[model samples]
Target: MIRFENVSVTYEDATETALHHVDAHIPEGELCLLVGPSGVGKSTLLGTVSGLVPHFTGGTLRGRVTVAGRDTRTHKPRELADVVGTVGQDPLAHFVTDTVEDELAYGMESLGLPPGTMRRRVEETLDLLGLNELRDRPIATLSGGQQQRVAIGSVLTPHPRVLVLDEPTSALDPGAAEEVLAVLQRLVHDLGTTVLMAEHRLERVVQYADQVLLLPSPGAPARLGDPAELMAVSPVRPPVVELGALADWSPLPLSVRDARRRAAPLRARLEGRTPPAAPAPAPEAPVLAQTARLTLLRERVTALHEVTLALRAGETVALMGRNGAGKSTLLGSLVGLHAPTSGSVSVGGAAPHRTRPAELLRHAGLVPQEPRDLLYADTVARECSSADRDAGAEPGTCRALVSELLPGIPDGTHPRDLSEGQRLALALAIVLTAGPPLLLLDEPTRGLDYAAKSRLVALLRDLAARGHGTVLATHDVELAAEVAHRVVILAQGEIVADGPTGEIVTSSPAFAPQTSKILAPEPWLTVPQVREAL
Candidate 1:
């Protein structure tokens, strides 16, 4: 269905080749997963398949890429739209229409499909992606995750033979992500559609992949083969594969069920001991932020309702739930992006909504779901320098933070040219330069690979230890298991559960980390915890 022949890509004004001699093939009706670290040309490779590289991105393509036997070099993205449905990393950029239902039907209308067929496919896609309640909502009013689902449904309604998705589940919550993946599975198995997806959250999709495409580094040779074989040697790994390696299991198990079948003795070894987790904040700790009976409305929809919460010094909290469950709303309220409809929100002894931007900088800083929003400077150096001046910090503080999170990023590179994860690291560094007492992150790990995420985890742990309070809204359960002292679950614009991380995540099957599920009857939340226990 897809083939890459001696593929090499070099962008205009770029010294190093973005992709170097990547030769690969995918047969029809197969689901291929593209795996690599940040800035390693995974997106570039996907762009080739969709004809976005040389056609739209102004890059030089030295080799041929074909989808369904049509050469991408000879065809543009629109010319190949009938056979290929491509969803890139940013959902907002993918939408051409304003409303959910209209966006879903737009692709089919472009294809000149009959009105009846378009309507039927739109309805089927809405049900398949669980988007019925949001059919009429403006795309801007919906949450990030909801927009992502709509973006996917739009392409899906066209019924393209080959579906190319980049970070398809990045914005989705655990349940929503599963639903989206299930829809992709049906497209591959029942309908014989070819799906090529690139995702950073491998734990959620690795088990479902039919074949794995491993790109070890930037511009390296691509490796494509059985999922199990590639996962064993891939630089990045999911929790299941990491655990299998820790236990020295031969060939490594790809799913929880397979790992469980071989874990009788391992369970015996860990029967009496529990995994160690970061302790929750002390009751007497100084309050950095708090919300009292807060209610917020957006587009007449109750985004947050009668919610009361608190964040204390030296604490890291993870806000989690299904898509559009008020997690982002709460974060916005704390950072003054959204004023509450009723009730009160205070940060650093002042109401965030009423505080000025300069004063609010001392109280809190936010790295939103879209990292690009916080960055406006042209180059990496300028952004960092500007952040330093705004925060009154030393000149190199932001640059050093970026180095710690993502090393080797050039100072002169345009922010737009950086990968999603690289852009996020720059945004985070800018936020941290202010040295705010409270830090807020929405889906901070969206594009980060395992190694990048580990650096962030360590950095957050260090920040908490230095008496800063952190609240991050996220769908990455593995991250919460590793770094959070507390976990708060919200649903339908209300707080449903809040407690120690291990207690809250382990109790809920849908939100539990992979290691916790494999080692059930115990509250183990990470592979590192299991390794430490042994």
Candidate 2:
């Protein structure tokens, strides 16, 4: 069990407290979900459980925090490793070994468990997380979802009484995310493990939470209660919850099945009405980029096959697929991070791989899967300044854009200290400063909440309206449905389907959004679209 009494945290340089007088108790063997907007201290609260807040993070803790009756204020993360296991957003940052089996055993080895015990736990964890097939693969070689499972398995091997996860399923595809959530459910139901997780993709996990913790904003007291009660008032909500609210359903439905069961009348009301039409394809638009029979291989692995694609100005393409389906790889090829082993790729009439860095920025700008890769300055102010100089923009252009995208982020804040969503916003501002003809974003909504994601959707739409070609690789089906003009799906390094967004998503059960699933055969992909129809 975890308990926080008048707990508050303030970093060394921060003026505002990350958490404010948070008093909550998470019962043993229960799964508690921490929900909040971006930069609202969800991660800060999770860190307090494992004593990472004041101990390793160099912060000041105000009151008592205990895990399994041990005061976390007095104990360090290492001291509580036996009872508390924490997995952060970045799985690569947590790994100490090269392969899956070794990573799983590393934590136990550090805990000084006997070799026999460690070996048995490793095998058990691999099986529990369904990583048997990838047990021998290098951690770096696995897809984002596989790496996430490996990260969770590495911590689960220790068999800690309390498991703390931050954005555990953000990187996973729909099926893999369900597997991870099911694993958590089993841990709570069968193993009696206390699971505390923070995730932005509420549609995937809210239904499974035993209780919900809402941290509305920084310096605000937390709210803990039944999931339905909190979701009714929570600013950040999943599509199902939003739909329930729209229909005025009592005890807002948290899952798709429940919402569907209650949607019969609404379906009847919508029987004769048609959903809004998707954007018409622009057959006469100029081609801004093209890849002809592109093939890419890395470490004897075929990441992308001989694939041909084209992006026209004013088009927004959503590249979607399962984990390890080469979405990221395809994005990389577009930005010249990976040169095609065969065929050609052209953006703005030149090969991206052959163009210089500065010149490349003129033709295309990429916001990679890891947003921090594009950020290097010590402070946000300097990062903006550097972006301005590199792009030859007006002195305040980057800063202005940052303000528009991430509003309240302080200029003095360290880039590393910003939340994942904030960091992505800053990275996106830097890329947009260049005014490139083509834009590439991979998993842009990884840590963004509903509000931030809405702003992103609007920004992308604005860019598309300005005749910029945009390609986004993401697993967020709702996001793709809302923003993309076209949808392209890839599988096993080959293009499986490419067409208008409505056609590609509504036709496929696996790719359909929550609203589409609830309003079955209705051709609706979002809550807004359904609301418009009604």
Candidate 3:
């Protein structure tokens, strides 16, 4: 269904080809998984299949590309829309309608489908994606994960023969991600649809892929082969694969079930052994932020309800919950973006809502879900320079932080030109340069690959060691297992569970990491834990 003929893409002013000369074939009805580190041209390659490279992105395509037998070079994106359904990393950019139901119907309307057929598809999609409850909600009001599902449903309703998704489940919670992936699986098995997906969270989708397509690095040819064969050599792999390697399991396991099936002897070896204790703030550590009975409402909807939480110096807390469950709202309240309907929130001994903008920088700083919200400069260097100026830091302070978090970023490259993970790293560097007593990050690992995420974990650990307080709101359970000392789970704008990282995630099946699930009854949360135990 999709074919790349010696494809290579070079954007205007780019120093290197985003994608090197590559050739691969994705037969019809196959779920092809694209694997690569961030900014290595996964997105650029996906654009070629959907004809968005040269047509919409102003890049030069040197080799031929085709989708459903139509050459993408000759066919524009709109021309191939009927045969291809593309969902990019950023979901908000894909919406044209205000409400959930309208957005789903709009795509079919564009295709000039019959009214009855459109209505039937809309209902099917809403139910298939579990968006029936959100059908009437305005797109702007939905949470990031909810918005992601709506964006996906909008495309699926078109029922294109080929589906191209970039980070489709990046914003979704565990349950929602499974539902969406199951829907895609159904499409491939029952409807004979083709899916080409690129995702950073391999643990969630790698098991479902029939073929793995890898863009190893910049200026490197792509490789297409069996999932297990490619994954054994892929730099980016899921926790199960990592564990399989750690234990020397032949033919690496791709899913938790497969890993668990082979973990009996390993589990016996780990009996009575304890994982490292989660990090904790010192008893004498100062309290940096406190929310006392905080209640917040937005547009007559309660975003946070009577949530009382506290963060101490040297503590890292992860705020986790399903989409639209008040995680982002709580982060917003910490940064003074939302005024609580009742109760109070304080950072560094001052109410965040009452603190002045310049003063708030000294107290706390927030890197929101949309990193672009904090970035205004044109070039990467200018953004760092501006961050230094705004934070009252010495020259090169922010640049050094950027170099640590996101190395190899060009000084003159546009901030908008960077990949999703690169952009987040830049935004994080800008915020961290302030050196605030408290740090707040919402969905910090959205587009970051494993290597980038490891750097982030190290950076956050360093910050915590230096006595900085961090409140991270994320759906990446593995990330929480790695960095968060404590976790707070919210539901329907209320805090339901708050405990240490190992206890909370391991106790809950929905929130447990892959290793934890595989090593169940052992209380393991990560590959390192299992490795250490053995």
Better of 1 and 2 by TM-score: 1
Give one digit per residue, the lDDT tens place, for model 2 in 1-534: 899899889999798888888899999999999999998899999999998898889889999999988999888888999999999988888999999999999998888899999889888888877899888889989887789899999999888999999999998888778888898999999989999999999999999999999998777789899999999999899999999998999999999999999999888888888777656447999898899999999879999998899999889999998888898888887778888899899988888888888888898899988899999899999999999999999998999988888789999999999988999999999999999988999899999999999999999888888888899998899999999999999999999999988899988877889999998877678999878877
Please say which candidate is ahead in TM-score: 2 or 3: 3
Question: lDDT score, residue 116, model 1?
Answer: 91
Candidate 3 wrongly placed segments (more than 4 Å): none
Q: What are the models' TM-scores?
A: 0.99, 0.98, 0.99
Candidate 1's displacement at residue 56, Å, is: 0.7
Q: Worst lDDT window (10 residues) for model 3?
A: 525-534
Which residue pairs of candidate 1 clash? Answer: none
Candidate 2's C-alpha runs over 4 A off are none
State the lDDT of candidate 3 residue by residue for 440-492, as single tens digits: 99999999999999999999999999999999999999999999999999999
How many clashes (backbone N, Cα, C below 3 Å) per candidate?
A: 0, 0, 0
Give me the overall lDDT of model 1. Answer: 0.92
Residues 267-313 of candidate 1: C-alpha lDDT, one tens digit per residue = 88899897765765678999999999999988888898899998999
lDDT of 2: 0.90
Give all candidates' CA lDDT scores: 0.92, 0.90, 0.92
